[model samples]
Target: MNLSSKSVLVTGGAGFIGSSLVRELLREDAEVTVLDNFSAGDPSHLAGLDGSLEVVEGDIRDSSLTSLLERKEVDCVFNLAAEPYIPYCYDRPAQFFEVNANGTLNLLLACKEAGVERILHYSSSEVYGSAKHVPMDEEHPTLPLSTYAVSKLAADRLCFTMYHEQEVPVIILRQFNCYGPRETYPYIIPELISQLSKGPDLQLGNIKARRDFTYVEDAVRGAIELMKCDRAVGEVVNLGSGIDYSVEELSHIIGELMGYDRVNIEIAKERLRPLDVERLQCDYSKARELCGYRPKTSIAEGIERTIDWFRENNERWIWEVKIAPSERIWRKDDGC
Candidate 1:
């Protein structure tokens, strides 16, 4: 689907990656309607969008999605809405399953009813779990270790099933560790940035595990590229950097990017996942072959850019972290 002058519906457009994709779609002058419940997303993310962008406050689990799609007459629907935080999923598996699994079923059914073509579903590398081999590809055995991972795996397979069984025009684009500005949950990058934002010491867990990180902008670009590739319909592709870096190594690089002096690193047992995936590296050869997907932002450059954003918006993250730190159980903080 050519995005230029087309109408697109981006669910969860107020999120970090969703907002980035909204900007990308707006650059092409596509009419966009963003559907979000603002649970973790903020209206501020979509503040500067021109008349081409429409913001709707709603839940992906709601049947109103069908009405919205019918009204907008969108050519494509991008499902980026889900309950994705790992810890949160552990605490409330029912909630995560409802939003990540059943909520997806709701949206896919709506898309089918509305005759919306080319639905791009957001997937994650967590579905691949610990890599049995280096640079895990789409064929990697899915041994999901966490509730969040299991929920996403269910949703990812649901997309494939919809495509094959119901003939729903759908594609699953799974991305590696995604990080950038407006990132609510403190992953390694934001945890370091937020800690530095307030003070000096960085508290983390399981720094030995390795991950393939991808910047938000490049992930959005890969998603859009996949959306346009006609051959990608009913297929799954991995958008990864094809490189893995340890959390400890990433922390030092982040410190370097932030230009920290005598950085204090502390390991917090509470911050670690109950069962951690040892390593994940992306084999995006299929992405390159199918959709010409190449993540442009390197970890160094992306960290620099993300640090710049944190520096500008220090108060927002700092205040939020102070209210509900990552060590404590996840809370529904509406401040941001």
Candidate 2:
């Protein structure tokens, strides 16, 4: 679907990746309507987007979403609405199933009803679980390690089912760990940046585990590219750097970039994943070949950019400010 001059509906556009995509769409002069429940998303993330977009405060599961699609004359739907936190999903399994699975069902039905020509579904790499082989590809076996993973896998399959059975023009993009500015959650990079700003000493879990982290901009570009590719319908592609990094290494890099003298790292048992996937490396050959997609940011460059953003918005990291006085003092002295 040519996005130019088309009205696009981005569900959860106030969230991290969705907001990035929203900004991109607006840059192309495409009319955009953002539907968000504000459950895990913040309106502050949409601070710079003034009148260029319409904001619909609602849930994707609600039938109101269908009405919004119809009333707004939406040509395409980008479904980025889902509970992404793994531990949160484990604690609230019902919410996870409802939002991730049932919510997707609702959106697909709405797209069908609204006669939406195209749909892009944002899925996660967690659905692949621990890589049975290096550089996990789309054909890799999906043995979800967490409840959140299971929910995402179900949603992903639902997209494929809709394309095949219901004749919905849907494309699924399984993104790996995406990090950048305006990311609110205590994700790895944001969490480390927040902690490092408090002090050099940081406590974390499973430092040995590695993940394929994609810069948010690169992931957004991949999504846009996939949306433009007509052949991408009924296909699944992985969006990632195709490189993995350990948490310990990430901490040291972030600390150094933020000008910290020394980073004291300790393992926090309570913070560990119950069934941790030790490693993740994506095989992005399909994305490269199909959508002409390539990650432009390296881990070091991405971390540096993220650190700068966090430093500029230190007020948002208030929870990380509650550490020991000595740690706080250290952070203050180090210009964090």
Query: Candidate 2 residues 79-130, lDDT tens each?
Result: 9998877776666788788999999999999999999989999999989988
Choose the strongest candidate by lDDT. 2
**Candidate 2 global TM-score:** 0.93
Q: Once superposed on the true structure, which residue ranges of model 2 sit more than 4 Å away at CA? A: 317-336
Candidate 1 residue 296 Cα shift, in angstroms, is 1.7
Taken over the whole model, the C-alpha lDDT of each candidate is: 0.83, 0.85
Task: Tell me the deviation in Å of residue 99 in model 2.
Answer: 0.2
